[model samples]
Target: MKMKGLFLAGLLWMAATGMQARGMEHFIDELASQQEVTRVSLGTAAMALGSMFTDTYGVKHIDVLCLEHCSDEVRTKFGQAIADLHDPDFEPLVSHSENGERTKIFVKIKDEMIREMVICHVDDEVAVVRLKGKIKPSDIEQVIQDHGSDR
Candidate 1:
């Protein structure tokens, strides 16, 4: 028997465009692709390890890391990025899956024009891809509000 996959192509979204630059240099290697990051940096170590599932992913703390490889600037920038995350922007990208599971990701490009980011996967692995893009708690809240869901 043969099987197909779920694929999403050419998705572009717009954000509020009212955020401050939070230069964060997180994300080391791509467990997946370039536009899609396979790792993130939360607050605690557990959160980092817990960042393997793409789906059901979220961080209760202000700090997090998806991997063990982090530079001091990246670490400091991560904290500062979170602290500086004022408002986040959303630019839809390509999403797809082949294992019968759907792969969803949202890339944060010019958040405050100082940070950049890529979305790896969601609802599959313990992963929350953040590519050093400027983002605020409210921005995340906005997504939850829009999606009618929360963490």
Candidate 2:
């Protein structure tokens, strides 16, 4: 009886892991085919592990890609890809475009708390970032404040 229980538990764990891997691979595969991609950075699992010690939250998967000479049409498609990943029930927090450049930020909330954030930017370069966990409004405020100070 003990061996049977162990075998069933192991099988369940393996199946769950496989499904998680497939979901992660789907996005990576989708982005791999795009051309003019100059640089790519992937830190999904790595960042999750590091987040435990940093007192940071709401960052799950991180992928950044820079593309040069990207056309307007391609940029639109990139934005759509990120938009499609968002939860349709709640509207994104920020969606703005100017001078041929675009930026969109999405957030998911549960129990009146921010749970996830996805940010995308396109223009001379394209970047897509996905963060999963908990986030607060003040975090956003501080980031924007610090960014303005840098300039």
Candidate 3:
């Protein structure tokens, strides 16, 4: 009798977890349908195929979602789901608003290097991008060092 109860409880827990993931599936499906998208370290084709065969490790787990005419309801739901899914250890790297636009960056790091970063911006449109895998502060500094003079 006790074993049956425990099995039922475990099944219920698994169902709940699946439902939570389904909430985020809407956004994942939408972002995946975009034509001109990049997967950072991985080529676009590998990223697409990776989605089918295995986990994101081979592709570094990077994902970008750009929506042009997104509704407030969808955006709000996505934000809520993101909050639910994001790591508790993530720290705010940047938070700024100017005029009617806002940009926020949050990151999870260890040993002074970023393990994952989430970049979200809402202005003329909405874009939420997540970058995973090895990303150090030096990678960012290099971008500034290389292109700071261009702009």
Candidate maximizing TM-score: 2
Tens-place lDDT per residue, model 2, 98-132, is: 99778887776777667666567766667766566
Lowest-sum lDDT 10-residue window in model 1: 10-19
- State each candidate's clash count: 29, 1, 0
Error of 3 at 60 (Å): 2.5
Better of 1 and 2 by lDDT: 2
TM-score of every candidate relative to the true structure: 0.26, 0.56, 0.54
Stretches of candidate 3 exceeding 4 Å from the true structure: 1-59, 76-87, 149-151
| Regions more than 4 Å wrong, model 2 | 1-29, 32-45, 48-60, 68-76, 79-86
Candidate 1 per-residue lDDT, tens place, 1-151, comes to 1222222211111121211222122222222223322233455455556556542234432322242244444434433333233324444444666664344344454534423344433222323454442445466556678787543
For candidate 1, report its TM-score: 0.26
Better of 1 and 3 by TM-score: 3
Ranked by lDDT from best down, the candidates are 3, 2, 1
